[model samples]
Target: MNIEKRVAELVDEKIAEINRPDVFLVSAKLHSNGKLIILIDGDKGVGIDECVQISRYVGFKLEEEDVIKTAYNLEVSSPGIDTPLVQPRQYTKNIGRNLSIKMADGSKREGTLRDATEDAVIIEEKIKEKGKKAEIVESTIPLEQISETKVLISFK
Candidate 1:
């Protein structure tokens, strides 16, 4: 099999062996320069210790199985806050947080995420007219219509 697929399988195996049901593999990529990047996420959040544990386990397994005969660097970590939401679980975990969404039709929306499911997400937003008080509005967006979604960080 291909190197990236093999690495992903090893990561899945390690997660199962360690019984980390909360943790899930986001992606595994073997770059051209022999860099193996593994991104993992959790229902809550992934810690540095979890990343180190997975990194070590996957690295050792790769060596033991001789998956990559040449020298390769292994890195395992959580997708950072700036990364876009790619999974339904990720959206569920970020309930009540602000999200900036880009639609497939080139529209954009920013609001507080109220609910999320397999099919769609509900967001609460505010609408203001020229001379009227702001009105609260909630919208349901289908998952298929969303091109990207990023959790908005407030420094306030």
Candidate 2:
């Protein structure tokens, strides 16, 4: 199965156990720079300490002690304003909101999200080159094409 799907399932199950459906999973990746960066939604009172606790707890559940091959860091946080634009389920969970997307060809688009599916996302936006009038534009992006995604926060 897809690694991300499996991870999401694991995270969802764990969050459910804690009764935090609002909970989302963010993971950290180790790069050649010797730094660890986690892709998580840092919100809902979850802190670094809490992230460690959850990581240990999840690792206990995974029990993959025999296969894991390298030292890794753990970080738990919210999906924040700029995370990867991944599964459609992620978008649907945040419908009627705004997000920024980078296309496969290095194009960036930002607009209010209308909806999402496992395959595509529909957005409502205003064309910047011409009229400021709002327009609804739907672009279908395969999961493979997404480089990154971030939640758009509106300042009231």
Candidate 3:
């Protein structure tokens, strides 16, 4: 079995044991030189304490099981704000945030994420016309047609 898959399985088991069903595994990668990276997400957001807890638990389990005979480094954390939204839950959690989305047709749109469903996301975009007041228009884009969606951070 793949090392990353096995690590994910162990992490899932530990997460269940801790009664943190809200936490879900986002990605797991076991790189050369014995570096294991695991990204997790929560319904709301992930906290550093939660990540540390999961990391300690997973590290202990892996060591106890002798999964890695050699020395290894484990890092568990959330996929930060800069990461693109890949899961439906991620879209739902990001409601009301600005998002820059790239469509499969190579078109891009920037808007406030209003709502998200299993099949599509509704975004409220402002339309600016020359010498005219800005108009807010809501558009729904199917998930299948979206190439990528990243949350836009505003310092203001």
Candidate 4:
């Protein structure tokens, strides 16, 4: 009885019932303290109303099925901006945004995400020579080589 996995399936069923193609599940985790956390996201974004709807629907289904015999707290929300991107759709939606990527080999890269594909991502990196002007170069990184990628926030 993998509670986390079961919760994820229930959330997916609710998402299908709601018919919001843009909205998708990011993660469903059940902590040792009886806390069930569900993270959802959308291609554009997710609103509080959508989170509420998912929470209500999933909570109802969980109660009806007696999935968790013990008392538990259910929390449903979107992953924060600081959270690293986990899904291909997340990367696709973030095209044109700057990203700070950490490679699996322990190197790091910062660039503007130009495009995202099933197997790789193209990013525009700024190359600077000590005495020369900065040059923009496009780099292609395979998805398997990336360990984590976070969207960079710009003030201007």
Candidate 5:
């Protein structure tokens, strides 16, 4: 199997042993330089201790299996806030947060996430018209129509 696939399997095994269903594997990659990068996320959030425990578990498993004979590096961590949301569960957790979505047709929409269903998400946006009071409009966007969605962080 390819390195990436093998690493993914190892990650899955370790996560299963950890017994935290909320903690899930986002992505795993094995670099040509013998570096393994694993991204994990949780419904609430991933802590540094969780990352360290997973890293130790996977690292020990790999070493015992002789997966890497030479010096190798392993890193397990959460996908940062700047990372785009990929899973439906991820969207569900972000309800009430602002999101910037780029549609497949290249249009962009910024709104506060109101709700998420299996196939779509409801975003509430404020619209203002000339000589009219501003009102809130909710748009339901199918997940298929969105090319990318990123959580927007506001200082205020």
Candidate 6:
């Protein structure tokens, strides 16, 4: 069996008892970097030591199976809020939160995101000037125009 298939099977078995049905592994063959990147995403709520134990266990299993011998980089991480938005689901996580979206036209819009779904989002804003009342505007944006997306962390 190929390494990818073997790794998947091993991961499935390793995380079987762990309460992380959402965990997934992405096997990426980096052409530029010339390395195999295994991206692990899941909220296991386990400490770093536990995660390392899992990796070691997987390594032992793979070694026993003689699937791989050389060492490669294994990146275990919790998906961060600032990760560039890839799918609608990513945007869904940041709903009711502040966002800064870069548009194709080189202009960036910052607002409180009201809602976001598979294809679009609602942005609420207000414009005001001296001696003039504030004018509130709502903008609906399609996902295509979003060049990048990031979550706004509030310190207050």
What is the C-alpha lDDT profile of model 2 across 10-122, one tens digit per residue?
56666677775555665644455433344444224355654565666655554563223445443445455555645555777777788787777898888788877777777
Q: Report, for every candidate in turn, its global Cα lDDT versus the true structure.
A: 0.90, 0.60, 0.90, 0.92, 0.87, 0.65
Ranking by lDDT: 4, 1, 3, 5, 6, 2
- Clashing residue pairs found in predicted model 5: none
Which candidate model has the greater lDDT, 1 or 2? 1
Ranking of all candidate structures by their TM-score, best first: 4, 1, 3, 5, 6, 2
lDDT of 6 by residue, 71-144 (tens): 65544444455666555655665577888889878898888888887799888767677999988778898988
Per-prediction tally of clashes: 0, 14, 0, 0, 0, 0
Top model number, lDDT: 4
Clashing pairs in 4: none
C-alpha TM-scores of all predictions: 0.87, 0.58, 0.83, 0.91, 0.82, 0.60
lDDT of 6: 0.65
What is candidate 3's lDDT per residue for 1-156, written digit by digit as tens?
567888889889878887888888888888888889999999977888878888998888887888877777899999988998888888998899999999999999999999999889999999899999999999999999999999999999
The regions of model 1 sitting more than 4 angstroms off are 128-133
**Which lDDT tens digits does candidate 5 get at residues 1-156?**
466677778777877888887888788887788788888888888889779988998888788888776787898989888999887878998999999999999999999999998889999998789999989999999999999999999999
- 1-156 in candidate 1: lDDT tens per residue? 687888888888878888888999888888889888899999978899888888998888788889897888898999999999988889999999999999999999999999999989999988788999999899999999999999999999
Model 4 lDDT per residue over 46-126, tens place: 899888998998899889989898899999999999999988889999999999999999999999999999889999999
Report the CA-based lDDT of candidate 2 relative to the real structure: 0.60
Ten-residue segment with the worst summed lDDT in candidate 3?
63-72
Candidate 2 ranges with C-alpha deviation above 4 Å: 1-53, 59-72, 128-144
Q: Give the higher-TM-score candidate: 2 or 3.
A: 3
Clashing pairs in 6: none
Instruction: Estimate the lDDT of model 5.
Output: 0.87
